[model samples]
Target: MHADTFGTFDDTLASGPRRTPLHALHLRRGARMVPFSGYDMPLHYPAGLLKEHLHTRAGAGLFDVSHMGQIALHADDPADAARALEALIPADILGLRSGRQRYGLLTDAAGGIRDDLMVARFGDRLVLVSYTTLRAPETGADL
Candidate 1:
C-alpha cells in the first residue's frame, strides 16, 4: 500500500494506466506509485530520490533495471544487423564498432528531427531502442 500511494510524484495517482510486469515487483519493493506519460509508474522508493541518488553515487545502490525499455536483435552478422537498424535510422549504423553504441536521430527529408534514440551493435545484430517512438513514415524511423 505504501508504494501505491506514498509520494507526491507517483504517476499512479490515478486508478488506471498501463503497467509493465515489474509493477508487481515494485509494489513489493515499497516504491511510491504515481501517474506519468499515460502510465502508472514509481516516482521513488522508501529511501526517497535524494537518498537513492546519493546511494547510487556512493556505490551503495545496487540497481536492477530489468523493467526499463529494452530491445533485442537477431541476425547472423554485424553488417546484417546494422542494415536492419539502418532501415529505420538516418545514422550510419554500419559505422558503429562491435562494442560501441551511438545516439541516432530520425529526420524528415526536410531535416526536421522526428525523434532522438540510440543504436548499438550487440552480438551480431543491430539493436535500436528508445523511450519515445517517432517516424518519418517513409523511413519509418524516428530514432
Candidate 2:
C-alpha cells in the first residue's frame, strides 16, 4: 500500500541493510526488502500486500517482529507482577488471565504516551513486547 514507512532508496541495493531473523526466508519468498525502524523489513512479498492481506485474513502469514523490544517480568505470583505493572501503567494488566495477551500503552504521569506495548501473561511472568521508544509530540520547529 503506502511506502512512507518503507526504505529510502533503491540505489543502495549494494549497501548492506540490517537483517532480521527472517531475512533469509524473506529473500527466498521474494519479499521486497525495505529499511524500517533500523531493520531490513519486508515491505511485501511476490504476493504483494493485497494478496498477503487476503491470505493472512484467511489463514496465516509469518511476520518479522524482531524489531520490537521484548522484556520479561517475573514474580513469585503472577498477580503480584500484574499489580506492579498496573502501578506504572493505566492498563488493566491484573485483568489478564494466564495465556492471554492484550495491547496497552505505557503513559507518563502527565498522560503523554511513553510507548505502546503488548503484554502477555504466562505462569508467573509477563512478557512485554514494546513497539518502540517514547514518541514525544512533534514540535512545529521540526517542520
Candidate 3:
C-alpha cells in the first residue's frame, strides 16, 4: 500500500492533514481519503457510502478511527472508577458490567451537554472514547 494513492493532498491548506496508521492500507484498498476531525481518513471505500452502511448494518465493517481521543481511568477497584465516572456523565456507569459499553453525555453545571462519549468497563479500569470535536470536562473536580 502506497500513501500516495490515498487521494490528492490539499495543497491549498497551510499544512497537510495528519494520517492514521491505516492511511497506506486504505489507499491500497482504493479508499477515498478525506480530511475529518484533523485526520485524513477514508470517507468511503470503492464500495461507496450506501453499500458500506448497508454492509455494516447487515454484518460487520472495519473502520479506522484513530482520530478520536481515548481516556483511561485507573483505580484500585473497578466499582470506584465507575462511580467516579458516573459523577461526570449522566449514565449508569456503576451498573455497567465488565465488557459492557454504554453511551453517556457529559453535562455542564447548568445541565448543558458538553459532549457525548462511550464508556466501557474492563477489569479495574474504565475506558472513555471522547469525540475530539466536542468540548470535554475540565478535570475530575469538575465532575
Candidate 4:
C-alpha cells in the first residue's frame, strides 16, 4: 500500500507531536509509531503491514481517526448553515437531507482543491469532518 494512504504528516510543530487517545493501546500492541498530521500515529503493528492488510481484507479492521478534524455548523435555520457552507465548498448542501452525508472538496480561487471533507446534515446543524493537517487556518478562514 502507498504511504499516503496511511496518513499525511506535518513536522513543523513547535511543541512536538501530539498523541491520539489510543496511543498507549497502540504501544501496548507493539505498533510502530510515525508522525502524522501533528499527531504521533501508528504506522504498523507487530503483524507487519502486509499481514495486517491481508487480515483486514479478509475479516475486519478498526482505525483510529480521532486525529481528524470535526466542525459543527449551527444556524437559526439548518438550511441557512447549509447555504453558508455551500458558498465555500462544491457540494449540494442545501439539497442534502437530514441524517445524510455527502463528500465534498474545498477549492481555491483558481479551482484547485485545498482539501477533501465530508458534510453531514443533522436535524439542527451541519457537521463537517476534514483532514487535521489543512483544516486549521484555510478552512477556518473561509468559514
Candidate 3 displacement at residue 131 in angstroms: 3.1
Per-residue lDDT for 8-66 in model 1, tens only? 22344646675655888888999888865445678889988999998888886643333
C-alpha lDDT values of all predictions: 0.57, 0.62, 0.66, 0.72
Tell me the tens digit of each residue's lDDT in model 3 across 46-97: 9788999999999998866555555666666677767767777888988887
Query: TM per model?
Result: 0.58, 0.73, 0.76, 0.70
Count of steric clashes across candidates, in order: 8, 0, 0, 0
Record all residue pairs in model 4 with backbone atoms less than 3 Å apart, i.e. clashing: none
Residue 22 C-alpha lDDT in model 4? 91
Candidate 2 displacement at residue 30 in angstroms: 1.0
Q: Residue 92 of candidate 2: its Cα lDDT? A: 90
Q: What is the alpha-carbon lDDT of model 1 when measured against the actual structure?
A: 0.57
RMSD of 2: 9.4
Worst 10 residues of 4 by lDDT: 1-10
Give the clashing residue pairs of candidate 2, or none: none
Question: What TM-score, to 2 decimals, does candidate 1 have?
Answer: 0.58
User: For candidate 1, which ten residues in a row score worst on lDDT?
Assistant: 1-10
